[model samples]
Target: MPQLQAAVKELQEKGIALPDYPDEPGTDAERDARARYDKVKGSAVNPVLREGNSDRRAPASVKNYARNHPQLMGAWTPESKTTVATMGAHDFRSRQKSVVLPADDVLTIKHVAADGTGTVLKDGLKVLQGEVVDGTFMSAAALEAFLAEQVARAKAEDVLFSVHLKATMMKVSDPIIFGHVVRAFFADVYTAYGEQLLAAGLDGTNGIAAVLAGLDGLEDGAAIKAAFDQALADGPRLAMVNSDKGITNLHVPSDVIVDASMPAMIRTSGHIVGTRR
Candidate 1:
């Protein structure tokens, strides 16, 4: 901890400010400095601290204390419309395949397209004996259809629409999924100006704030912005991460992680401590 603290202090002394969030604005030099510093931030220490075990559980002592002194609970009723939506088919869970390594070896993962073109996804991956390796894919068509249905369901049921993903942990896949969610939610806007938005270099994969950040550079930026606003107005009451700041759940990928959020929801009777719309 002291070493980490000293490293942070040294960075600060060099005029590199590390904020709680990654989106803080800075000069090009400061931003470059932050790019390096970010490698040490958040769960970067998990490999050292966790030592391969990431399945988190409270200790017996803490559990005993919690059982004795219970916290305030949120009310739940049979009439509650809260629901857990998931794609039981064509999702990662359904499509996962696993294999246990019988011997230590280096491997490569490749993809073959419909046209018989091959591409290397990963190479030189080392594995040990008895280590379990798994691979999974979620169908984009199925994901989009699922999201579209959920959005319409939320609107129909007059419920708050929100998505929780572990982008920080499931770094590659979750961000891509989050991007699909954003596109699905703002279907009309994307349908109308997707080509232009893509041309302007505003990728939805980085989150809505990123897309919004680059809007000023587009010739039709104002129109695109208005369309986003209109989508929000027309869509179901979206859950706000911070109603005070107009920060929706879709604004940032790291704000709501499943493990962190599920416990909070359980404590609050399925509530995420956020307002609707």
Candidate 2:
């Protein structure tokens, strides 16, 4: 994390003024003189409370000031505890109205690799084994194209490809439009991949459905394992769960020989996208 002092210093170096300090003494008379001067000047002389203040004041300071000087900061404003409480209640109600469930009838896929060691092939192939037998190298586009075809085939076989949205730096919202945007974006991706799969004669029985349920009911580990199990049972496993940018692989028993190619499909099929938040 960047240090607050460094940020402040940078701002100062950039000629940005710090927030005015209304609490700082301006005159010996203090309250009376300050109030009189404010009335006469029609502005606060204190740098912290002055009009057109441009200082990047921290929230903590504002909160502290409100806490210590409720009489000064209007009680009806958001800074007041009573107002904040009211806003909180109102926000809760608003969220209840705006809350959206996950997409509809979606089944998630969890990919487990050899010892959970999986690599993400964004636009390239990761050769986990022998060198290019013919010294042939596959480009990122080629690899992505290959994986996209496989995902499409899976989708055709009533299996939906997990569509993911890269929402790093996305702001949280009670009524989120980004969800719709994500759905639309991934729909396009699946469509394109589906077309490629068809061209490659790999399109199979796959079904795409919206994710409608929450994972709150299951334990953490159970939920993770359940995703993998469902992928095995379901023909076209689709998971939209968030993943770190890196790839992971899990080694399971030899008897649990899932498809060797399935992990690659899951990693590239939009299941591994992440966000900053």
Candidate 3:
């Protein structure tokens, strides 16, 4: 835990209020610490940089297409018996853009392998002084509040809750956030077994199915699974990615992105697929 403390110190020194890194944290302090770490892990970056000037409008292409293809867009009617609910980290849209300047630039991406090898991912292009680049969140408290509000709202409204994240584009980031939502939704299970799960190479950022699958050889796997099942029963209704397979939207990060899922929900008159039952 000293290492975690040191890491936390390092981040804090750099202005990041990172939670105490939880490596099999057990006590309430540890569990709370873990929760802190999880909440802060993914999807918590956009708000800070937004500073109210970030670009968040729908793209021109989407608007123009919507205008030309009204039929493709859905009209909200009072008689429509559909409810499409969507939520994601606020930073999901709080994205900033940096342009490549023409004058001076020296930025490069490197790929490091486990064997201590390095490969260049991108060579920094020369850029002018005014050129921009973007930085990307919740790896703690900020994200936990956002997700909790979403769950509480959905519960009060009695509507299916679905999270829409840019898992594909974000690749590592979004999925990690998705995992946090999973952990938040099933707090008890993770609190009790996060240590074990982490041992199994599972973290809160993978699909629930992955966690379930990762439980394969662990001793308390069956008991933990039961907890997950009970969680589904006790929590707010979740939107399904495949109700037939008992797969929920929180199963994978990129499974349900906003752009794709939002329009699809509209097309279906505001309800997610596989929730008719």
Ranking of predictions according to TM-score: 1, 3, 2
Better of 1 and 2 by lDDT: 1
Where in model 3 is the C-alpha error above 4 Å? 1-102, 107-131, 137-139
lDDT of each: 0.83, 0.34, 0.72
Task: Write the residue-wise lDDT of candidate 1 on 83-200 in tens digits.
Answer: 8899999999999999988987788999887799999999987676776888888888999999999999999998888898889877788989998999999999999999988787
Residue-by-residue lDDT tens digits, candidate 3, 1-277: 2233445577889998645567898788889987865664554445433335556788999999978878655567897645543334545345444565555556776766769999986794433455565544232566777778777777787778788878865666677778778888887777888888878877758788888888768999899889899888877888888889877888777678888898798786787768632
Q: How accurate is candidate 1 locally (lDDT)?
A: 0.83
How many residue pairs clash in model 3?
A: 23
RMSD of each: 7.5, 26.6, 16.2
Total clashes for model 1: 0
Which candidate leads in TM-score? Answer: 1
lDDT (Cα) of model 2: 0.34
Top lDDT: which candidate number?
A: 1
RMSD of 2: 26.6
Query: For candidate 2, lDDT tens digit of each residue in 81-200?
Result: 110011222232333432233332222223346599755433222221222212112233333444446445655654333322122211222113223322222444335343443343
